[model samples]
Target: MKRRTLMTSALALAVFAAVPALAVADTLDDIKARGTLRAAIDLGSPPFGMQDANMQPTGSEVESAKLLADHLGVKLEIVEVTSPNRIPFLLTNKADVVVASLSISEERKQVIDFADPHGVIQVIAAAPKDVDIKSVEDLKGKDVATTRGTTNDKEATTQAKDANIVRYDDDATLVTALVSGQNNIMISAPQIMNAVNERRTNDPLEVKFVLKVNPYAVGLRKGEDALKAAINDWVKTDLANGKLNAIYKKYNNVDLPAEMPKP
Candidate 1:
């Protein structure tokens, strides 16, 4: 009877010891154990996340993800995702975190959590230098191009109800429509539109009006407080150390605003 009691106590203590390990098993632990951080990015959006001339993923968001991976001392696995799929990728566990140019919105908050603002992105209207689109109202009766189902599209549709809004499949296609003169104006992030204009000296596009100022943030799966805190801590450290500013300047050709908001 004493031997049986001793065996039971030993088993209980062993299980108690294992419980703590299981309790602490979280996304961060899984990431560390896997030795790779999977970062979802919108590879089509230049200056934020895009492929470089060598076909390697290179952009501000890509660099930011790299920074996180380096901070965690792990390799980065780039997962290409579209704007609409960023949340789905995270929820489905296909991506550990989304480094896409994701703007924080209340609707999205219901499903996923966001880290502090990593950068500020301006959604603006761009037009050929000769075009006279100076404001949202100026877009009336004009052909404006934007990606379907994006904030730009929603804002343009709402503000310029009478405008001939042309919807494209993605930002690349929308920019193509604008540059090809299929559309008189395009609403997009300033970084990408400016880059496109810089490449086209024949017909340079200029930002006519700023529509929205969005705080871009990293998206993580819901309920992952540890992961979220780690990401925010990394952002805070990098922001103070000028690492984020350097990355932003490298891709966007401008420094990140000193007063950029934190989480």
Candidate 2:
């Protein structure tokens, strides 16, 4: 009887797991009715997402998520995520939208849709200035640390084939590893690399080479047209009014691109 019950439960779970994709209208309506917008942000990525001195969530994407919820006339419910699980959270209905620093990639596009981009981030290879790393070719046999399951990971894995890729679970861990001298060479954002340099001042890291400049957007599950349209509209308005750019620049110390790329 126990085995039979377990089988029945498993069958029910499988059916339940398939419901999110089919509940397109419910995703948007539910948020409005619930009076809260579920916005997933990864606090592990500083400048993009992190905690303040008070331990309150304060960062670029965190503020952006707040703006989104406010624009929708709803309260914000932050759903913390990591580099690896942002999309999974959205697809599983754990998050109505993902405001993590998720770059728009053809690879990701195959799995989920994205709103219009509100910001851009440059992926770079950084290392202690003494280390000679001029390009991907220079990464041969070097230990390159990056957050696992991120775009930097994909770039390093595919492009820096000769390098020994060391992936941490998230950006915070990857940054900590760099500061403790666990890894010298790494593929990451300039902001993250700079954060590491601030700690290891005696042996500062520099941008060895730029890997890519990607426009990041809010991620949405496919078929959620209402949510996508709402997010896209908010991005356009905020970008035009300089609200989004202000929030981005406040945290990143750099202005957003002159024009946002479409997702």
Candidate 3:
């Protein structure tokens, strides 16, 4: 009788212990109970997430976040975060989820769960208005500038091994280097290039030779199966309902792919 009782007690304890992690018990639940869902984002990347001249957060990710929060019947809170800090922010419970422009990668999958990709971005070469550069190959032996610690830097280094690939701490400095003639071409996403061109009156910089295509998704902490599934299901529904495409089209001139890439 004691053995049976102990087993019962243990099972009860196990069930109780799982309360904090249950899909019905996680931050998603807390948000439903408390009535607000907070998200973390990198505000520097425009058309994805960024502040306008009025300092209000506006972009594809931001609008999607708002839509999700609304669908969940909760208020939405925005937390500013950088690329390097996104995982840490989610892991530490600083945010309920991350709507940042985080790339979905196998390496990252080991640490965090990713939702169905909502958009695709690519790294390409951006050159001055009159520069004769035609492709990534033309960048051979020329100077290339890319943002430090980004996929841009890695791709640039690999494609232009002999070219001087300089890394800047931020996009601003990288563009500054390019505009000042310290670098010949810049490696970055077309969205970022568009942001730069918006500020420059001298016609938009030309982009060419797409190096790599990156799909972006919302990120969640690992081990949150319920939350992950819920978020994924929500994304799928949005896609089916045409809500996802509308959000992306509202912010970017580019269109999003209809389905997530296969694993």
Candidate 4:
């Protein structure tokens, strides 16, 4: 009877020991254990993530990542990604979370999960405020600059059939071309549009026409409920406390919508 009892007690201890290993399998636990949060951000996209006048990284997304890392109680390791590779980096374990301006879509949902939307991005045709681009017809025979593999690319390639679409790998390159007078018209968000004006005062850019507005959210891996729930809660708390809104306004120079769209 004593031998049988000892065997059962050993078996129970073994099972209990395995529980912690299983718990740590979640990405959230892994991040904590690693003592660093790998946040993927697209530094090329201003107001989201970009360098300041001193070439130091500073933007809404950069701050957002900082907030997230703070909440996680871990050090932040920014994994810079372009629009095309953001999702890939997350899926391949190169990043633990994607805080880039990743627009939530049914198509993207099919691959990975997203937390509640933190903000919205408007895709539009923009040019110098002096240029009158009242309609798509006004874009005829013009060169349109846009970042490749982005919703902007899809919108421009689909809508502006007559214009020559010039695609770059990222927003920074595309914006540089615009500021240098290589392309007068381009598809971009209000954040980038405003950035253009700050850099090129002579030809202040303005939205010619809006293409679409999409709610952007943090990207997480599918089946990682722990990580997803943590981010969702973080977004909810910060959004309610006005921290997220304050950060958004500080960089984007605009307030987040009063009624945020559902993710």
lDDT of each: 0.82, 0.90, 0.77, 0.87
Error of 1 at 48 (Å): 1.3
Enumerate residue pairs that collide in model 2. none
Instruction: After superposing candidate 2 on the true structure, give the runs of residues whose Cα lies further than 4 Å from its correct spot.
Output: 1-22
Candidate 1 ranges beyond 4 A from true positions: 1-25
Lowest summed lDDT over 10 consecutive residues: which window, candidate 1?
A: 18-27
- The model with the greatest TM-score is 2
Candidate 3 lDDT tens digits, 1-263: 99999999999999998865674346667788889888997776677877788989988889888878877788999988765577788888889888976777777788888877777778898877787777667877777778775667778887777777877866556656655567657888888777767765465677867888888888887676666777777788888888988988887785677566653
Candidate 3 vs candidate 4: the lDDT winner is: 4
Regions of model 3 farther than 4 Å from truth: 1-25, 170-184
Cα lDDT for residue 145, model 3?
Answer: 78
- Cα displacement (Å) at residue 259, model 2: 1.1
Model 1: colliding residue pairs? none
**Better TM-score candidate (2, 4):** 2
Summarize candidate 2's per-residue lDDT along 68-153 as a digit string, tens digits: 99999999999999999999998888998999889999999998899899888888999987898898998988889999998999
Per-model TM against the reference: 0.86, 0.91, 0.81, 0.86
Q: Encode model 1's per-residue lDDT on 1-263: one tens digit a residue.
A: 99999999999999999764454348898899999999999887777877778999988899999999998889999999877677888887798898988887777788888999888888899887888877877777877788776677777788889888888876776666666667767877887687677656798888888988888898887767888888989989999999998998988888888798543
The lDDT-based order of candidates, best leading, equals 2, 4, 1, 3
Which candidate comes out best when scored by lDDT? Answer: 2
